[model samples]
Target chain A: MTAAVPNAFDDPAYRQGVVELLGLLAYGEISAWERLAEDAKMAPTLAQEAEVAAMASAEWEHFAQLRDRLFALGEDPYAAMLPFQPIFQRFHARTQPEDFLEGLLKAYVGDGLAADFYREIAAFLDAETRELVLDTLSGTGHSEFVVDVIRDAIAEEPRVGGKLALWGRRFMGEALSQAQTVVAERDALTAVLVGNADRPGAVMDLTVIGRMLTRLTEAHTERMDKLGLAA
Target chain B: MTAAVPNAFDDPAYRQGVVELLGLLAYGEISAWERLAEDAKMAPTLAQEAEVAAMASAEWEHFAQLRDRLFALGEDPYAAMLPFQPIFQRFHARTQPEDFLEGLLKAYVGDGLAADFYREIAAFLDAETRELVLDTLSGTGHSEFVVDVIRDAIAEEPRVGGKLALWGRRFMGEALSQAQTVVAERDALTAVLVGNADRPGAVMDLTVIGRMLTRLTEAHTERMDKLGLAA
Candidate 1:
């Protein structure tokens, strides 16, 4: 199906969408950092406590960069971000991971999906916007330390695999639900990406998307298995 | 005041108090890092946001060090910290600064007074403990950015002096009041410091205490003036 393509920067709706998405993500990062830092206090060792706190703080740089890009796009960051509060808040409330492994799984799943989503959108944007989105998505090293922890934990507990695998499924399920809601409610924003691309239906390649998700799941499973979990 | 001096570390009451105070302060640092990471959202610029988050994260390291020291002294980190929660929580709640400058002011005042308090206690401890406390207090670069901000603000607005000066007063009043309360509630702890190698009273030297307070006040006033605030 043929779709109308528009210059993203010049489209007020697209620019506003950018602002909205960035603002919401920025706020999310700030809150995440706080929660992670506090949660670190539950750690049995001082070393782990410091590690979590530092990881929490590391999110701020990416949050700020995305925010700055939004501001530069002339969007009212807060206003654009307001529409996302309900769904985002609900996700957090529903998915408060009970254990350290669960928390790491949550991060691993969330960051991987987000990175994938943004990477897809980046392809449809102008060169400058594409670079910014790509940079923002890539710059935050969210998965490295998380993978390390999962690996170490699995090594210590070979039987932990099943619990973590179940946890991972739940985490992804919640995320998918959020994505569906966003798509259903945000046509203009979706249009900004899907309708803006030259190949039109190229954005709707289900096989490609499925492969990406499968790969992510596979990687996560491998990480858990390496840790001796029932992946 | 002819006060009987007690060997603080050896004295159960004093040792407990020391543990309690230090534990609270250590936990406070950890919480502060988390809060700052959260608060960095108020920053309008990404660079500034990252900087604040980094500082917040760094607090965890200090917290770990202090926690280790507390454990070394055979105290329950959480138990020692439980008593001062109300006072500390109240102070933080009342002084929730709205923006970056206010946040900086809070840090500056809190860190400065804490360092001074640590120095006072260091003198009464064993050489190793004293050295550890002093090193921890001195190594933290809490006020470096604050001084830069104050300098810049003063350069920008000459009339900001009065407002900041008042802020400084509020900070000091609250800190001093809490400190006095902590001290009054724990006479054995005071005996720990005052009773040392010399006569407890001679070791404390009320005149020296008065002089240190005066110097701190003067330094704060000078800072306010430099920040173009009324000193």
Candidate 2:
């Protein structure tokens, strides 16, 4: 891909596409923030609650960065964020965690999946926007803390491993279904992901998209295994 | 206060009391985080939701600070936080925000009252500990965002003012009662707040306690008025 240029943003459709991606991400962070905070209540200890809240708040910081980018692009940050709300809400409603461990697995697995997907999509974006999106996804925070907690939990209760492994599968399924729903609705966003002619970098073929999904799946399985869950 | 010396921590009882107080504040931040996030779901717009989440995340940052302080004192942060769980849970259960506006008022008024109460108590501590608590309580993140939203809502619907005012009163009553429950249960905490004979600063009597409550109440009223609600 050629180096990104300000001239790319000069194209109104390209600007709108980038704005849409940012908006999708901004709302995604808000939804993640709410879910993680809700899960914090399920934490068995204050430290764990703090850990989850910390991750949720970290996600909000990313939300702010995205929103700021929207403003810098001369767009309404909230309006940009509004359209994708239902998509994320639907995803969360379907994958609601049943317990602290389930919540941990969801956070760990869900975050990893989203990060992988975004990283894959970034390949089709202009360098600046790609960097912004990747940075936002970089550490949406449910990191080592969730992993340690989930591993310790499965070790203590072997039955938990089976349940969470099932939960992990369910989380992945609901997420993919929601992604399909969103892609079906958001023509502009889908075009950006699938590589529209004017959509920044090299256009992606069906094969590339397939490979991306495969990579995301492999990453999800690895994360699930690390949590002592059967993928 | 004689310049805070390392010797103060050398007094095991004082150290224990400080640890207890940090635990209370840490748990308090987590509770605030949960409530704000819950309230975020009630927000009428994505903007409002982000605002509430922003405040909740800020509270989590404070939780980290308090937790770090606990660790610095060689205490297990979660273990220290455990004992105060029920107290905050009881307080939250009683003062739950029924909707977005009520949650805004709670975040605004409740935060103000807690900040005032903590500031008053800080007067009884060694300089270092006083500074730490004061710093954590400094900007509880319920400032322009909550006040602006509440003011706008009440301006649009004056009747909400009356209900929120009453809600504010109930919030105060519940908070005080829960605090009383905590003080009655944790003698070390009470000693830290009211000042034990062998404690650092001057001992507080009933009159002083009454005055502290008065100060917190006055601050609450001011905040309520800012929110366009009567106290």
Candidate 3:
């Protein structure tokens, strides 16, 4: 049993931080949806395109849920998402996938990274917001599809694995750089992560934050390994 | 009450015709989904992009339903869709939308044309197949959104109306030409339309087919009128 509106919302800063986090998450979904849809265009076959398109639709559905939550919180969803657009745009621009395999690797690796980071942040959020964040961040149930496709491709051509492995590293680098920019610019979101003075119980100390990063990296490595790509 | 599988499907030729028709319709949806997703990228704003993305997802949903029906009929969904892919590809290649407004108009008017044509064909189908065809052919509910957006744009720049009107005509021309090629090449699909020797009752004579064409054209004109464009 949980409160529909958490007591954490009583603090104005906490509420603002949650709103910013939701905005970021929602925008991330929209960005993922757009990129996946674009990747579907380069799919090698119609069946593969449909699979990617299904993933895109799943992302859109998650975005809609986050958007509705923003509305319920009395914020303009689009306006909330506006500030983070350029960060994602730059990340996507710098890491544009050159082919179908690159696209699959990016979708799997990039999304895995974002989901890990968000799950860490969800730890500091109120129950309701945490639940929403975790639920939406859950994979679109296509990770196996990506893993199978990439593993088969790599098996067919040993050289392709080397290229995709390098691609994964580049995607992670770009994602982290963009993420750091967001953290530096968004005080409210940073407060949510490290926990502000108003939310003493949620405080994550420097060591804890460091450990979170290690966990994220390890998870990413595991995903890359699953795809037969080096981290 | 309707039969789960129509008695009409008992005839091998009729079954082949329906399978071919479903293949064509499913492929049309996948094609529309791809094009709509492309159109979303050209959207002027994030909100508009989401709207278009929603329409794309709607198209994908229709494709899934049709694909499932194909599977139930012991057909490979992708293989069913393959034969008609080139026809749609050619149609899309010739009528590529040049901008945001053109994309919107193309989505609205082009889908309207396809929907009208399919509905006419649905009349010749058995009750179950007719229901599926009609259900999927139904608009994605974004017609009003497209109408409002295009109407506002034309209002802002009166010249846009003239340009879009011409664009509308070009889309219709390309669609009709591709449709002609399909009708000429697909003997089974044509059999569905004209009523084959085996199914005397389902046979639509030349006059009826001509009237169906007239109705299709009138619907297209009405849809164009709704968009404040000439048919």
**The best candidate in terms of lDDT:** 3
Highest TM-score against the true fold, candidate: 3
**Candidate 1 Cα lDDT to native:** 0.64
* Chain B TM, per prediction: 0.79, 0.91, 0.91
Give lDDT tens digits, candidate 2, residues A91-193: 8888888898888888888788878888888887888888988898887655788888888877898888889889989988887777767666766676677
Query: Native contacts retained per candidate?
Result: 0.26, 1.00, 0.78
Ranking by DockQ: 3, 2, 1
* Alpha-carbon shift of residue B35 in model 3 (angstroms): 1.2
Native-to-model Cα distance after best TM-score fit, residue A85 in candidate 1, in Å: 15
Candidate closest to the true structure, highest DockQ:
3
Could you tell me which 10 consecutive residues in candidate 1 chain B have the lowest summed lDDT?
B193-202
Q: For each candidate, how many residue pairs have backbone atoms clashing (under 3 Å)?
A: 13, 0, 0
The order of the candidates by TM-score, greatest first, is 3, 2, 1
What is the DockQ of the complex in model 1?
0.17
lDDT of model 3 at position A156: 95
Assess every candidate by TM-score: 0.58, 0.91, 0.93
